[model samples]
Target: MKLSKNFTNPLAANNPVIVQILGICSALAVTVKMEPALVMGLSVTFVCAFSNLIMSLLRNGVPSRIRIIVQLVVIATLVIVVDQFLRAYMYDVSKQLSVYVGLIITNCIVMGRVEAFALGNKPWDAFVDGVANGLGYAFILVLVAFFRELFGSGELFGIEILGDWYTPNALMLFPPMALIIIGCIIWVHRTINKDLQEK
Candidate 1:
């Protein structure tokens, strides 16, 4: 039951993006298109999951004074691995992502989970929490990208979908539009999950 909650909570009630608003920068930056957004999401999920596991495994022996430094090293190492993997196999998408991939190292969701949850939990539980939080962030990214790419460019993944008859809305391509969409998402989400609303 505890493990299941760890895995499920972040997906909705405790979503890292919509509820906690933790990873809004990447969500806005990469969600210009579905392809990059999806890639970014997967990359984060992998890094978050493994970083938590590794940090949790090391939590015992690491000195409290150096805990943040150690956690950063672990997170940075994973970000490097992901960055290289993207460069090696997915060069085009990687080029599109640019430095945002490396920026994952500083993502609050990743570091926050390592400090907040992984430091206390067993490795397996920590891993699940990481995966759940990562997915929560990813879910918002992909959804925002879907609308932006479809309406902004009349395309999804670079293949035109809306056809020539449908005029692409240039405003949708901007960061402000992403924020508006995210705002709408937050409004609807809070409406359904009323507990998230301010008392």
Candidate 2:
């Protein structure tokens, strides 16, 4: 049951994006398009999950003074590997992602999990927490991208769903629109979780 909570909580109630607001930069940058947002989400998921597992395994041996450095080393290695894989397998999408892929190294969601949870939890639990938080972040990204791509471009994943008569909203493609979408998401999230609003 505890493991399930680790995996499930971040999906909604404890969502890293809507609640903690840890990874808003990528949320704003990548959601301009659906495909890049999806790729970025999966990349972040992989990095967070694996890094957490590795950190949990090494937690006992890591020197307290240098644990942050150690976590960075692990995270950087994973980010590089993810970047190389994207370049080789999905070159065009990777090009779209650009520096944002490398920026995953600086994503607070990744480091925060390692420092706050992985360092204290068992490997399996930490892995679950990482994946859940990654998905939480991804969920918001995909939601925002879906709206942005659909209304902004009159398409979904590059395929037009809106007919020729339908005109796209150029504002949805902008960074400010991402913020608006995110704000809407938070409003809805808090409305449903009234306990969050109480505090």
Query: For candidate 1, what is the lDDT?
Result: 0.95
Q: Which window of 10 residues has the lowest lDDT sum in candidate 2? A: 190-199
Write down the lDDT of every candidate, Cα atoms only.
Answer: 0.95, 0.95
> Candidate 2 lDDT, tens digit per residue, 1-199?
9989888899999999999988999899999889999999999999999999999999999999999999999999999999999999999999999999999999999999999999999999999999999989888899999999999999999999999998999999999999999999999999999999966
lDDT of 2: 0.95
Q: lDDT per residue, candidate 1, 93-145, as tens digits?
A: 99999999999998999999999999999999999999999999988999999
TM values, all candidates: 0.98, 0.98
Candidate 2 lDDT for residue 19: 94
Q: How far does residue 152 in candidate 2 sit from its true spot (Å)? A: 0.4
